[model samples]
Structure formats: structure tokens, C-alpha cells
Target: MIRAYHQPSAVEEALALVARGAVPVAGATGLYTGRSRREAELVDLTGLGLDTIGIHDDRIEIGATVSLQQLAMASSLPGMEGARLRRCCRHVASRPLRNMITAAGNVAHSVYWADLPVALLALDASLEVRRVGASPALVPIADATHGGKHAWDGGLITRIVVPRRAGTLSFGYERFTRTATDYSLSTACVTLRVDGSSARDVRFVVGAVSARPTRLVPVEAALEGSALSDDAISRALAALDRELPIAPNYRAPAEYRRELTQVLARRALETARTWAARENP
Candidate 1:
């Protein structure tokens, strides 16, 4: 159980508490969801003023305390980034839960089965964190989640930053579950830039079945410079099944997840195509 709760008034104070074994909490969604078993002191992060969302140098900087409901507001998102964020945030959960979950917390906790991290991963997002007794550094979303090379390691994630594309960019995100509000059994996201009819800079991320979101590199490489056609999409699906290895669980068999991955991948590609057409046409 949490023995004490401390709401530090400054960012440095929070970092100090984190270095001393106190758990820093912005949203505490995962903390209270039985995911965090061991607890020390709860360092409340709300008082540190890490709740602003702003655009600087075409980068969207979201405070660690920004809630899902706040991000779900489409009007607040400036461009394609806003549209993509709203698209994913709307499916997060009911109103009350969205209000309680923080965007940075969503990425920081690295819940493999969650949506926000998967979406952000596909968007090529990064986090700004302050480590104990160290200068703040920006870590890629991939590394921060899933214990990648640059792990969070008890650091306080202060903000989430993603680039704003200056040109036409197509992207899509989709998740599969037993129900609309249920945690996804698997999730996929796609982002690509189009050069005429050819797909370029393709990023395909699959999540929820593993400890971290993964890039479908083989599939992405297959579609990288090719025209997105029915045959190509089918080939990409084949490559996904052939190249992406999945582990089975009681809730979802490996075969089932493999097939579901294809379905979600196709849907995301279709969504990307649709948006690309709209932006390019």
C-alpha cells in the first residue's frame, strides 16, 4: 500500500522524490488498476503545472498531466496530428476514465495492451523526461516504452512531443477487442507519406500482444516505395504473417492474433489511403 502521498510544488522536487523511491504519479490510472503492486510514497504530479498543451516550432508539446479527455478534443489539435490524436483518444474509454488518464502516463506506464502508446509510437512521438540528478533528455517513444535502449528508469516524464508534418501525410490507427470499450487484444497503426501514387516513409506498428509496440519492418519495407494496390496490400498481409512472430495466450491464440493483425493492418492502410486521397487530391 502507499504509505504516504507527496504533492511536490516543483519539477525538481518531484524528480528528487522519484530518485528516492517514491512513485511519481500524474494520472495514476495504472497505479490504481492493480497494475502497480509494490507502492512506496505517491508523489502527486498535478501541482507541478505540467498540464499545458502547446505548439512550438511545429512540435506539439503536451504536458504529462494532460488527460485523455483533454486530448480527445478535436478542436484543440492543430492539424493532422490533432486529427490523429482525437481519433485514438475518442476510443479510449468512457468519459470518467478518459478524464483520469494522462497522456504522458499512458506512454510512461507502457501498458502493452493500451491504445495511447501504440498510437504515439506509430506517430513517431518522443517524451521529455528528467532523470534523477541528471539533465532532462528527450527519449524516443519506442525506447521509453518496452524497456528499449533508453528506458525511463524511475525518471519523471514531463512532456510528450510530436512533430507536425508540413506536407501531406497519411496515417491510421485501429485496435481489435471483444467489444468497443474493451482493452485491445491487438492494435496496429500506420503512417506513410505519399509521393504521387507511391507510399514512402511507411511506419507500421503492432502492439498489445507484446511487451512493447513493434514495427512491422518487413511489411513496411515491402510497401515502402510501391503503389498501394489490392495486390500489394495482400502481399503486405502475407509478409506480416510470414515475418511477424506472435506469442499465444489464453485470450487470443497465436493464429487468431496473426489473422487479426492482418485485418487491423488492412483497415489502417485503407484509412491511410482515404486520408491521403483527401489531402493529396
Candidate 2:
């Protein structure tokens, strides 16, 4: 038996309600784990006025309740480095599921294969978090969503803000999956910003290969100011060996995942470079 479901239109009211032990549920799609016996207050965030998808200066502010569908529809959001993330969100589960899956909901769950958080980290995004009787503050994407390193206590993710990419940018996503809708065995998000013939900025992120998203910083550092070469890509891929250690899982063996991560990361980077060349030319 579920208790009362409160719908507050403002953040203060919502915080007050949540401080009283209400479980904030933006979308309940991922929380059906046969635990109905342990029912608690489900605070529906649908009416919290947190469903905006618009560009706020150089950053794109995505309200916590913004659905995956809305994300897909607004693929051209300012500062959205790559549409590959939106593409991943669009095919997540099914139409019905995407209709209910919220960006904040998915991130809060911190599922292994959730793609948005990984992509957001690559874009250098920040999350606006608010808690009961505390001042709202922005936390870097890396620190804010670090798996098991830190936890958000009594804090609600209000919005996600991503820095706008300058110059020509390209993005690609690689997911190892049995089908389009299934959770990824491993996924890669790659983005490249170009200035003339040189790579201005490069980002590579792999998901499901570790407990949290691993940003290939060594690879990014190595590729900056270099042309998109097969050798450069190989070096970037090699950097993964030291960055991530995949654990054996039901979906794939540790070795298999490690190799797939390298392959996918390379392919994603190549694809991004190709698109960047075309866009900048």
C-alpha cells in the first residue's frame, strides 16, 4: 500500500516535503523491484516545474523532470556537444519507457548502463543540487556522480547544465548490445572540437566497463593539437588499459569488455573526427 503522493510546484515546498522522508520519484520506471511491501511516500516530481529544456547562456539547463523524449526532441540544444547522447536516450527501452524516463531519474538510479551520465561527464557538465535547509550549489559532473566515492544526502538534483562547445564539434556513441533497446554491455562517447586542421579538444568516455564512467584523460591529453591519425587513435585506445579494469559479469567477460572498450572508443572517436571535418570544412 502506497501512502500519499504529493505534487509541489515549487522547489521549497518540494524540499520541505522531501525532508519529511518522501521519496522523490520523477519516473518510477526503474524502481519496480518487487519491493511493494516496503512502501514509502512517493513524491511525484511531475508538478515540480522542473521540466524545462532550454539554453541558458553558454550552458543548457535541463530540468530534472525533463523526459528522455524531450531530450531527443531537443537534440540541437545549445552546448550539446554531440547528438549521439540524445540518440542513445531515444532508443533507451521503448517509446513508452522513454516517455517516462527522466534524466535526473536515470542518473539518480546510477545504473551500470545508463548513458546520459557518462556523456554528460565528457561534456564537463554540472548538476544543481538542493537539499533541506541548505543552500543550492553546483557540483562538477565528475564529483557529483562519482559511484561509491560520494553520495548525495537529502539532496535533490534540480537541473543539469552543460558547457557549450565552441568551434566545430562532432560526437559518436558505440554500444555493444544484443538489441537496440537492451542495456549496453559497454558504451563509448566521443567528442572532438576542431580548429582548422588541429584538434582543439578531445573527449573520450567509456561506460559499463567500470563502477563509474572513466574519462580517458590521458588519451584526451595526447590527442590535443594533433591531426586525427590512426596512430594517435591507437595511442588513445592504449591509454584505456591503465585507466579501466573491467570485472567479469553475466553479459561479458572481463577481457572481452576491455577489448570492446578499446575498439568502441576508437570507432567513436573516428566517427566524431569525420563529422567534425565535414562540419568545419
lDDT of 2 by residue, 180-234 (tens): 6788888888777788877766787888877667787887877788787887777
**In angstroms, how far off is 123's CA in candidate 2?**
0.9
TM-score, candidate number 1: 0.93
Per-candidate Cα lDDT values, in order, are 0.81, 0.77
Which candidate ranks first by TM-score, i.e. highest? Answer: 1
Model 1 lDDT, full chain set:
0.81
- Name the lDDT value of residue 228 in candidate 2: 75
**Prediction-by-prediction clash tally:** 0, 0
> What shift in Å separates residue 95 of candidate 1 from its native position after superposition?
1.6
Candidate 2 Cα RMSD after full superposition onto the native fold (Å): 2.2
TM-score of 2: 0.91
What is the Cα root-mean-square deviation between model 1 and the actual structure? 1.9
